[model samples]
Target: MKSNNTAKSFDYTGLKRVISLGLSQSKGLFIGVIFIAVFSACFSVYRPYLTGDVIDNYILNKDLVGLKLEIFKLIILLIFEGILAFFTVYLANVVAQRVIKELRVRLYNHLIKFKLGYFDRTPNGVLVTRSVSDVETIAEVFNDGILVLLGDALKIIFIVAMMYYMNWVLATIVIVILPLMMIITRYFQKALKDVYQEERTLVSKLNTFIQERLTGMNIIQVFNRQQAEYSKFSSINNDLKKNYLKTVLYFSLLFPVVDIVSALATGSLIWFGGLRTAAAGDVTVGNLIAFTQFITMLTAPMRAIAERFNSIQRGLVGADRVFDILDANETLPNNGKKKLEKVKGKIDFENVEFSYVPNNKVLKGISFSSQPGETIAIVGATGAGKSTIINLLSRFYDIDSGSIKIDGIDIYDMDLVNLRHHVAVVLQDVFLFNTTIFDNIILGDKSITLEQVQEAAKVIGIHDFISSLPNGYYSEVSERGSTLSVGQRQLISFLRAYIYNPEILVLDEATSSIDSNSEELIQLATTKLTEGRTSIVIAHRLATIQNADQIIVMDNGMIVEKGTHESLLAKNGYYANLYEVQFSKMNS
Candidate 1:
């Protein structure tokens, strides 16, 4: 996503930053590429002059021996030019690959440290495009942008100088066409710059749309929205097509105009040089031929300059996008110096208030406490701020006001990593990676061994069920554990949380989606998982938390009642009514 301050024209700052980073990677390679490009440009300009000398000074004088020697020298220059050209392209790409690799890695590392709100607000596809596609575009700055432009610029300079030295009148004729060609190029360059910006924007939209549609294909199919979704995709795709056509239209207009001017210049050179080539005239057969070659060489780079300018513009546009991510201040502030080596599990929320959006508070002046070894269950209807409490506890979002303390220190004052390390949350929607069951449980933590994982699963009473699978703990799971039943995935999540051995455990409606048989196993697992840990449980099913040391009933972001199950039942208040509603359903 582009910010309001995004540059609409050529971004010089971004270009400079990209160049600085590239040089930092390998200054030797960059400097070597430039040196080779200069030499290559000089060779191209001199080759035509050598060809003219062979015609006038050697071949025309009937000196076959001198002609062969000049021809041999020409061949050597061509061989060296070919060798330099190969190295120039090869080294430029090597530099590009290395630079983008560093940029991509840095961007990814920055993304991982960003607060959850950043991902919540920005689409995953946009970030993916920035990290992968946009970074690739920056490579054009090296392969075809900067160094190529330098070589072309140098070719123009050398060609013009040589033309004037040979014949000032002919050089002036070619120079007259140049300003007009440049004016035309400038017009197309501006038009194409705007089009390229639009093109990248449309591509991001296309990528974001496809990513979301594929992820939600099930919902689209279930609701019979295939035709409607297709229509939406077509609209986005059509916009991209139109954007590409605009780019084509500009180039289509640009080239013909440039060719016309180049042909006129070529025609003028021959007309003047032919008249001058008469018997007492100063221009010889060789000078006329060399001047003709000069016209061709001069216009070639001019034409290429127009194209390369756009390529450079496109890369600059991409660099702006990539740098946007790098410059963003979206990462969590980890300024606390206190390390949490251990915690007593005592939790407190002192008049805490928070909102995902300003003036739309989700948790309002809420306060609560749990002892070192106790279970605190919270029950509420949807949107009653049940899960918001858990999010605040984990410091996923900073509080609007007031404070939350763990053991006696304010959570804000604790090291962010250490604070999160001691808290384990098993969400209702369990997300598992596409790996073996053992890997998912350990989550790449080598400190937790397979034997330790097996032992933890046994304690949670899911060991036998896992052992029944063909690969046992080594069984492969599909993305998000889609191959497993909801109950099975949830069971694994509990085992994952348990293995971490957190000081505070949270199960946010963990058992709501389980079947009747799996519910018993989950209930038993919950007991074992929360045995000595200070636990917070959020449940829609009132019966699940009957044994909680304290049950807090909430409404509209505020707690309405708090007490033990038996005590709340005696009050016949919010908790009693909630319990009664579910109790009646169980009987019916």
Candidate 2:
């Protein structure tokens, strides 16, 4: 879980995987788009030659009736072309949107299965960018880019063929310029692709910075460091600006090179074709005119090819990043098929060795157990692995060694979904969604009714407090329940766990930050929440867990002492020392 802010190299394997996945799922739509594009290319190639025919057959001959007829036909073709262009844009987006929907869902499913430690190192903003901004960039590859590119490429091919059929010598003049244009374009592609990746990385960094600063705005304002924070943001903003400018710089240079090459091709067509027409009386004036237009058509697609090629490269960069997440080896395994209809909640951990990072063990061979309907409290200093126990039992992270069991059955052999469902937790830092209080309590468990929520709230003695709100259980809580007090959030969490009706309940320092009044209410609620359930409480106050059937004191990842609170106080060891310190603070 160690954080590494290193740059990624180009991953073509990932690029291919992304392309295959997107194309395979959108095969019919892609074929339809290509067919439309080819039709557009045919019209493009035929139009210039049609214009040449009009010049030679009507205007030069002065046959006004025939000219009128040809002009009317051309108008009809132009209208049809417009309609084709419209569908080309529309259908490309339809395909892109469908592919993006599937990819985004796949990314979410893969990301959620990642081990908790993976998130410890991965920033929230970076992931947000992955699922949102980067995915959009990938969509642009098809929507704004690839469909147009296909039309342009076919147009170029058809134009070249028409020119050669009219006059090969004139076609040769156009062909000679292409190699140089492609070379310049290749350089632009490499240059733009590199900068695009750097640009995306900078964007992710900026997002991370913004997300962190906004979340910690209270801290920044209290310390009056707004100016300092502004300066840091400016620095990041400048880096993004510079990265963007590098892409712009490459584009700025590329367009001028393309323009110069285009002028040279057009000039050669007019000069050489004029001379040959004058000397040999073979090449027609109409051929010269058509050749210039043909060169224009061809060079436009070349420019497009370069531009769209750059866009595709940018999409590939995004695809590489997304694939990296999907390809990670850190997902939690769900190979076990055993399901529990009703858990008896007898839990055991034997010689459990665990670590967030390699060789930096956080839980060292800890052994403990709780029988059904029994209550156990884990007492420990910060980083002594108290919370780590809950994490392992719920399979949030797999233990490095040894076993955890519930009701004499190994938890690793139990269905992960069922195991998590029955082992409910009210975290110290409760997170409430910005929604109605009733929704937060029910949390999408359709089996639980609103009445059940009220019943549980009453059991926890918060029914009156809830009903006092303007909308009762329907009252909206602000983001992360900032509108509610810490204790109130804790109470809602208790109600959430209770409504779920899990067989094992974990209260990890649930009352640590609450006011005395809230603590008393929670103490009354705890009895009802823990009744008939195996309960594990981790608390610093010590008073909340004094009646715990067993208390285990840990230090530096090892269980240093274990017994009931009174029995441990009699032993006068680590638990006794911690209890005495808290008791003295309360007395003072």
Candidate 3:
């Protein structure tokens, strides 16, 4: 079932916490960034002051020497301001990259620790988006967005202070337009945020569609569904395009509107400052020129603030998605009570009941026990809860009620890792990485020698087949072992389990996919693999398990009959009927 809380908005509290965490890691660079921003703002104020000084002290008095000195001072201040700006950008970029790297690591580690159920429910594309695109967005916010906000805020404060000191009446005229600009910007920011968020969601969906299609391309071709797939992809692509256009349109309108407002503010300053100078003679020509420049400067910071706010909104959206994954509950605790230095391989299941969902039980009050080194065979129709029993015994999922003990201790009380270490399963569907055959076989114990790998393969009757290949045991398998046949993959899986030397061995229809010749070899290998271990074989072929010490017949999540094959045949019950059906099919 899907989570109920999926539709919630981005967590603002979590976002603030993440920002705080990032700042704490690179506090020094953060402090330096602020210092440089303030330094640049102060330097910006000096230019207008120097220009006013040039007009009052030199131009008005016809002092050429003083004009030359003021110009030189302006040049020096510009150079210093340039240096400060460069360092501020450089330091912020450096810190942003470092913090992003650490954040990525932390996110990846958290994902790895999450329970298998999380991966089962989450789409791979969605997780990939959080790790890649989301991190990139946050990095941009740190590097460019934060710096813009800091620099512009300081610049705006300094400019307003200077404007008021020079002439309150002219400053008031310019400031009057600001409140309207702010109101308009507030509306624009809200509308833009929604548009951008929609765009981001569409992008994520498109990514997921592409990833799923590419991974299953073979199935599409086999089913002649290429046209259908193309149509689906095109539909999503068009939606993405629409979202992108909407986002761009909103931004386009916002930028031009802000620019027009700033222009109007500038015209107001020029007109009002001219009238004041005409009346009082207190404002010189150079001071009026400086006031115009200050009004122009106001535009830069306003635009910067608008852009920064836009970035922050998008960043919050991305952060919300990332944190959603990080906050998922982990797997149930494996707090098995018994700790065994060595397992004797006896396993018992008593009155075990389990259900992935309530009122839909898959395994019902099952009861059974196997002696150490005994081979127990389970036979049943499809959906008979055969696999569910193995899953429960392996502790993949806890039982709803009842007890399962391995070597006489409750499975839940044993250390999870240690318990899993001693149990091995060879399943019908095998998964192999893109690595050498030897490496695949030795996956359970990488420290084992190559000779040990060969020995295990030989026991599983796959050594000759592996050696016949061009690279022999060193031959590299393709991803998912696509280059190998199903039978060959199963052989490799058996070898892997054999190499682990597990105390308990499980074969869940392991030989069902192999040909008769390979099945014979696998049966022989299975005998060797389970020679000294407790073995549970879930199979459809009755002949294969005829020699088992115990045979269980399960139907609809219950063990209907249990006994030796000979005894069950004598009883003429569920096992006898199942055996006859299979035997008649084989004879025919």
Candidate 4:
């Protein structure tokens, strides 16, 4: 998760690669569009020709029969043109929709597979903007810009050629202004593109600010910081407004300049053609009229080029943002060939060193081991690296140095999914999806039967609690489980971990949130659950781990004391001091 500035500067080659990938998925529709566009361009040539005929053989000569024939041909040509235009628009839209669908799915899938560290740094709103806004912009580019650009370029060429064939003098006068028009358009395009890029970037930032404040509105209100938040939002909003105004101003300046240039070109054609006609030249009144129409047609396509180029620049900027996510390195790679069929639950950490930041160690030279079916209690103050150990065991982040092994093979040598499959974690901060209670319980093992879910819930002493609900196991949990009490969420999370029945379990203050009554039941259930599994418990209450097979007391990322409860008590060291403080607090 780089800053927005860094993201903006991300290499566009990757974006082009992704665009190429998207187009490859719809080669058939693209080819069809190309074919229809050419056909449409061919039909466009007939308009100027018919107008010339009506002038030379009918208007000047007063041949009513010739006029009727020319008018009939014009009607037939219009009918064909209408059909080609409809299909070209239809096929282009179809292709655009398909490309957008595939691109969105690919981006979402890539996002889900990214490592935990990636999410830790990226804001939800930034990711959402890339997935939604960026994809939509690219789709618009495909539907309007690419399709029209192809057809219009062809149309311009054909129109110019027909005008020249009808009468080269009028054609030359009309075409001479094109070079000047092009130069002005190019300048406008570059300026507009720069402004549009700024506009899009500011929009993403505004979205991020709004999303963050809205999601944390509760915190803002509780802290009585509404005015502060409003001020912050206003700052970002003002930035967005400035960029938007600049973009609009550039577009405003562009259209008028183009219109004036086009009007001049048309007036020049009419004036010069009239002179040639009066000189007894081949030009007729109908030819001059058709020439004006052809020049008008040129205005649309030329202006279209300007509009299309602007849209393309905006889309490219968005694509760059999207490709940044797609190209992110997965810090945790799944390169392991071996799968643990049945782990012995034996774990070892030998001379392990780790740090999220370089050269600043969080855990240093740590060595420890747990036997099969053994309970290891880790007790430490806050920021003592208790969570870091669990993170390493789960391989959420790789170690900077040394090794962590399960059984005999290094954990890194085991398939990441399989390694995690053998381990289950119940954390203090539980997360439940907006789904039924039964579904949440079975989330750890989707294949578990209803009976299995019930059995695990009963063992964890939450079956009756869930049964008491209005919908029982079918009850829907609101977002973040706002409908349930904190203790209830904890109970449900414990049941989820028990249903998995992994060989290794880690509980990080899992019971700290529950009331005393619920804690007793959870303790009882945890005792039963760890009977034949390796368990690591991190708790603030020393009484909870009195029966643990062994206790390792940590301080500053190092094990200061290790022994059974009775042995550590007799040693009168860090463990004795910790137990005495807790026991004194309870008695008071």
Point to the candidate with the largest lDDT. 1
**Cα TM-score of candidate 3:** 0.90
* Candidate-wise lDDT, in order: 0.88, 0.86, 0.82, 0.82
Model 1 residue 238 lDDT score: 95
lDDT of 1 by residue, 1-588 (tens): 574324445667777888898899979999998899899988988988888888889988989998889989999999998998898888988888889999999999999998899999899888888888888999888888777778888899999898888779878987898899888888887777788788888888888999998889899999999999999999999999999998888888888888888889889978887887874587778887887888788888888888888887788788888888898999889887788888989999899888999999988889989899899999988999999999989988889999999998998899999999999999999999999999999999999999999999999999988998889999999988889989999999999999999999999999899977688788889999999989999999888899999999999999999999999999988888888888899999
lDDT of 4 by residue, 1-588 (tens): 332433332334644664475469788888889899999988987777778778877878999888898899999999999999999888887887887788899898888777777778777778888899977877756677677678988998898888777777788888887898789777876676566667667777888888888878899999999999999889989988888888788778888888998899988887888888899776777888888888888887888888876776676666666767777776568888899789989999999998877788888888889999999999888877888899999999889989999997899899998999999998988899999998888874657888888887787677888899999999999977879887788888888888888999999888777876576677767876787999999889888889888888888878788899999999999889989999999999
The sequence of per-residue lDDT tens digits that candidate 3 reaches over residues 278-310 is 997776787777877887787778877777777
- For model 4, the superposed segments whose C-alpha errors exceed 4 Å read 1-19, 444-446
Best by TM-score: 1
Q: Which runs in model 1 stand beyond 4 Å of their true positions?
A: 3-8
Q: What lDDT score is found at residue 319 in candidate 4?
A: 68
Q: Worst 10-residue stretch by lDDT in candidate 2? A: 1-10
Ranking by lDDT: 1, 2, 4, 3
TM-score of each: 0.97, 0.96, 0.90, 0.94
lDDT of 3: 0.82
Instruction: Give the true-structure RMSD of model 1.
Output: 1.6
Given candidate 4, what's the lDDT at residue 358? 79
Question: How many residue pairs of model 4 clash at the backbone?
Answer: 0
